[model samples]
Target chain A: FRKRQPSVASLIQGIRDGDKTALSRAITLVESKNKTHLVQANQIIEACIADKKNTLRIGITGVPGVGKSTFIEVLGKYLTNQGKKVAVLAVDPTSSLSKGSILGDKTRMEVLVRDENAFIRPSPSEDSLGGVARKTRESIILCEAAHFDVILIETVGVGQSETAVHGMVDFFLLLKLAGAGDELQGIKRGIMEMTDTIVINKADGKNKQAANLAKIEFTRALHFYPPKENGWVPKVLQCSALENEGISEVWQTILNFKDATADAIYDKRKYQNKFWLLQTIEDNLKMQFYEDTAIQQQLEQLTTLVMNAKVSPFVAAEQLLALHQKKLK
Target chain B: FRKRQPSVASLIQGIRDGDKTALSRAITLVESKNKTHLVQANQIIEACIADKKNTLRIGITGVPGVGKSTFIEVLGKYLTNQGKKVAVLAVDPTSSLSKGSILGDKTRMEVLVRDENAFIRPSPSEDSLGGVARKTRESIILCEAAHFDVILIETVGVGQSETAVHGMVDFFLLLKLAGAGDELQGIKRGIMEMTDTIVINKADGKNKQAANLAKIEFTRALHFYPPKENGWVPKVLQCSALENEGISEVWQTILNFKDATADAIYDKRKYQNKFWLLQTIEDNLKMQFYEDTAIQQQLEQLTTLVMNAKVSPFVAAEQLLALHQKKLK
Candidate 1:
């Protein structure tokens, strides 16, 4: 059996049979290192992509130790308890820097990890600004093929550079603690304006009062935010991930959000897919544009000229374009 | 006189002698359309950059309608009254969409605009991430050459991207509102950690308690922040920008920050300058690399091949690199 190489068709069939190992292996094919696997991966993806319509894709991010894993573990368990299969994909962006994840997140999410109705996959947000989207999106399809009803994407909060996940996900959830309201001053308003919902995590204990006060303040603050074009309002929720308080209510709010904007959700997903396609093409073009060989010498010389003040940067750019144009002809 | 065709040396001399018109013209000269002025511009920059390290560079940002203009006006007046010359560069980023500056921040800064010890310039953040560095860097040297003691860079508070100004400034001040503490959940935490201080604006009137409460919350939150590697500790202070309350204190905090970090400021500047230099080189290289005809066609063809699964992105990248290496020879 080991002698028979795994094929994309077989992988897809395994996923259809609800094989967890196959789902994991299919994800690997999607994120494969071998060039030969790309064709098979693409084919399997096209075939196994079942109607991923009912699934809720939520991106949960917070500064480290802000209870992302704990919240997901509790929330995943809650959703699974309600007769839904929950899939959790926790991505560690810091892994790319440190070579292997802190690996602490999985341990924190022990309950969810062990649940028969839940599937947990912790991925590495390898050195891409579109962090985890390529792998995560493909992984979501595999989970859907395996009949998981809901998907939760967990990303280690990137501080300010969060657009990568936000642009891809359906619902973007930001978790924050009480007492640091002023820290918001340093964050960009664009990111705030883009958030779908913001959760005040760790809302129990002595900080309970501060958390309640924060919830009220955030509600008023949400009023100032321009309504998202989808006509869905971003709600503020207070949750004690440790105590599992308000967990079901939080899930209820998400369902309410889905029911309120079902039509728009599909439309948004279509647009988001289109955006990723174009974006990937554009990014590749930019990468290729800069890493070409023929112009390497000319580019180096141009930089030297500009750096030495012998020419303007604009002129250098123009000259390079002119040379490139001539060479292309 | 209108047709004087003023040489750049004469322009620099005039700017050095406190000629407001000349200073404005110099900014345009650096931010020139003709491109030829760049060579002359750098000569002047090199000349003026010498013996001009006394200016305090303050970066100020806040969400729209958060009193950034009003606070700048008040702070500008306060600095000027202390017998210190000030220059205000109000960056208008939203103009990219509107195609014109809204509110004309300089006029809103009435007191500072009228003060003889102050100079105010409001320009669109056209190509913000690019243009700000070009014009503002030169403007700072020009201001320093003219003996201005403080240079306040008022940038539109667009989250995630606002850090561009933070890197270029000596002190990064994030402005917030008193009761509007809830929106903090939506903003990023990295910017907060990068900030030198958080100033709560509009702190007077019915919002006093909210402002005090915000201060207490901020003090507690700052504890979670990792101390700045530059040996700077971010502080939270309450100020009423509308009433001009705490304006002097705000300026004093900046002064104290400089004094405390005096020994490392030069090293920081050197590192920052080198960073920008490498950044510029890398950005330019990227643009030129794809434009090179030697592999442009091949790259595009490879893209389709990859898209169709004939090749993987990694292989495409490797092939492109090989071509680049050959071209290097």
Candidate 2:
């Protein structure tokens, strides 16, 4: 016989009492596509928001082979050792297509996965980055309510995932492999602007000298960027997740950033809240308009006419909007 | 007595015959906010769309003091001397507030303003960037119909104007002073990614060596960026717009870029058309939602609640959207 599912009230109580199982179940509800589950998830989210403890949300990103998993594992363990309740989540939108990449294998985190104070969750399988980001954001609140003092969001630094992760986190860490030519090829266009710290990973063994040089190169490169709005200058450091070296220094830099930008952090979160409020409404509005059968039928024809310069894009947009409004009526 | 307004048919015929007066009048209609003028503007735009000649649209941007007006003057004169019809336009969203900082004074381009083969138009006074961009885009079609072989769009690079200009043009040019610390300040985060060429201005006499050094620095910096989507690599050039030196080289570089990216240009324009279609629709949708008095009344309260973590932003958005839908019903 299958076990009975717990009610929303019991789940909330358990999460408040720091029950990892209840927190995971609540997050599952948040990730569900079912209509009833959505309503229940919102209720849980509402309750959790009020009960949330002080939390630090850090987003870590790097290319696929940049050792993001190893770095995260070591950092998560470090925090747990400091008596912090740590929660690890991934935001890989491509997970659904890749059948789960980052954090998919629980064995990747080995020691951290087995730790009593650590909770590790794989990315939700979602077709859209927006969907995955929403799930991860909600999970953050749920994790916080479960008394997780530190929440680490991991994403592969490709496509628009870094941007999504950047929006949700307090500090954004970009991991890079030394001598990988990332610095020479340039990091992605906008990624550097969003980064708070750059960590050159695998800085052990033969890679030590190269990693230091890479750190210096990145430091000089970071100087070119305009001052960040939060008034915290971005720093570059070298680390070796393999040897477990410089991990504490990375953590220390983050603490320094947090201390220096305390007021800015409050303002950033407020701005992020407003951004999400508008973003969600806009996303839904577009989905409603684009999903309409009548609009879809005309969109292709209108797109062709606009592309060929036979009709002004503005006029075509006006026509479709009129049709949508008429359908609504 | 007021002169009689030209009929839409006459205006179209005149623009087709390369009449500057007709082109100017049509653009005025495009910029007008009056409902009747808007209708007439659409008719003229529809007519001109079919009559458009093969034209190259180049967007030039720099900070206010970076000699944008002088550069455009020199470039426009060069193109006109090459037996090409040139039209210069500006897209300054801040024009209304700044009392028209750019291209506001026709005397700034005194030589080009007097050339029968060239037409210059100041930016329309619009409160929003979208409004100004739409006007400039429609004006481009009208100018192309007027047989202008090349269109020059100028914008101040301090804000989102460059992005608006970038979206509408076939080529994007960034102008900067040699030692203005822009290269060291990193140029704007995403500006370099969109640029096809960087022109270091005022590279004459005392500034020539510094300009060349700046050029080398920029070339190295540009290497760090990933290869652009269009297979063509960006080039850096130094020019003294005041002395009209290197102006021809700038033109040559543009010609070379056009030759190399001819196919990409076609594809880019198609993509831009679709982008504008969706952009126009989305902008309108947002306007409709935000402008509703009832929605505005509740938005602030919801924003505060979301910022304080009392309500999920997603939930607040849903509540507002439902209210909006119910009101519509």
Candidate 3:
């Protein structure tokens, strides 16, 4: 509502005062479409990017169940118990309107959400990739700038497109159930190839045997996976999110993965950020060049011709390119 | 190797005799792009199209080590035992240098390969979707024309792109290890959403509890999945491919699914076929038109200017369209 304001002054002051709410709001300001805010947001982020690079970014995903919230709660508690400042950034892909999540995720992580050393923020997917709401990547930078040691991102569907999460994180953990029957049929290889760690949940009580069996099967399966450049093979473990058993073990695995992959982390993060930058540029060019006003007039005609097989989308694209060149000349 | 040259009179007589080898040679001739050979090949397949649509197309996919081969052997035997014909068309995605999978895959399924009632052919992926070996889809039609009652497609890799199997099959069954820790995570929502039935494999020995728990978890997960318009909700079952237990049950499940989905079958198949037809046409047009001699010069120049950002790709596209429009006018 208050549009005419000095955002730069507020941003610097909030950051200096170490305000998480201010940092989140500032990130929202950066993602806002208003042209002026884009420039300002970019300025603030650019100033903080150096400090942000040191934060450990982790991407956690699975199907709706598999207890994502409970795991995060246990993981968050464990991390904070070790005196680490942790931020849990969750993107619930189920529409905010539809009560679609496996659990009322935010409400379920009550203990961790209330922790002083832990910060939990849940964003509605707004129909984005697996519902990890938009701009959460940018928000991670802000969180890192604000000094959250471990930043966890959770999404809904983990299809090939879900590799976007893989691109943004330093370590990728795949959470599995105690026994995923036909474990082979349940998962696709491409997703498995990207995983840094695979944790099987619900390993407590009667489920222990199944969980251990799953672990053995997964370890065997992991062998076929090509070794990572840093020579770190994904580790498989069993845990019960409800019982809080083996949560610490999962934490230890992550720590080991970090230690093993530490030297490559900065380079990996930088390269990933660059990849995003180029991808965004390509996307914007496609939209602005091909989808906008000047092209719209010609596109309709091209579509009709192509639909009738009189001309092709290719020829039309070529011709359009020629026109664009002429105009620029 | 001796060239088996046939006399012109005998070749004509052989066609009249309905010789299967002649028919297969004719089909292969049609699929070849050898300019002269293509003319003959096209004639044969075109003549055979009427006979091709009768095959019962089945698609089978699972992650590695899901006993996909063992299950296929059992199903092939069952079909053969019932006095029906079966063929397994496996597509392996590993490079041609993997000592030609066509040879290795057949060796892996010794029983089915040796059976006179069945045919087993393993093909190299030729580097495409779902490890697509060239013309395998077309080959299904050929197999059907040649009187195979069931055409089973076994694809390697259980990942996102493997959904290509879904489009081509009457039934899509996913095999999984009974209890693998990463089952839930590895399976992903996309895979869960696409599968018609999930059969948890290796349900023997100590993994029984794991299998039961997996069934429970999968059942719960399936509840969240919106029922297919075909009224077929993917069923979860336990099976030991090695023990041959539940093989017949799996077949019955497939039959049940087919009978139930029969009503929606026509529309789904029609939509899928139409999609591929239009998609192929679009790809053809794109490659044909842009690569045309006339469009080539202008496209290169425009690409350079646009790539340098000296002129926007849009503006360059616009100029090309104008020139093409002028030519048409």
Give the Å error, residue B10, model 3.
Answer: 17
Q: TM-scores for all candidates?
A: 0.66, 0.96, 0.52
Model 2: CAPRI class: medium
- Residues A291-322 of candidate 3 have per-residue lDDT tens digits of 44665677667655544334322334446655
Ranking by lDDT: 2, 1, 3
- CAPRI-style grade of the A/B interface in model 1: incorrect
Model 2: CA > 4 A from native:
A1-3, A98-101, A180-182, B1-3, B99-101, B180-182
User: How would you encode candidate 1's per-residue C-alpha lDDT over B10-46 as one tens digit per residue?
Assistant: 8789878988877777777776756577767766666
DockQ of 2: 0.65
User: Clashes in candidate 3: how many?
Assistant: 30
The Cα error of candidate 3 at residue A277, in Å, is 7.2
Error of 3 at A231 (Å): 9.3
CA deviation > 4 Å runs, candidate 1: A1-3, A13-22, A47-52, A59-83, A93-133, A154-168, A171-257, A260-329, B1-3, B12-22, B60-81, B94-117, B124-129, B155-164, B172-247, B260-329
In terms of TM-score, how similar is model 3 to the real structure?
Answer: 0.52
TM-scores computed on chain B for all candidates? 0.88, 0.97, 0.80
Better of 1 and 3 by lDDT: 1
User: Backbone collision count in every prediction?
Assistant: 6, 0, 30
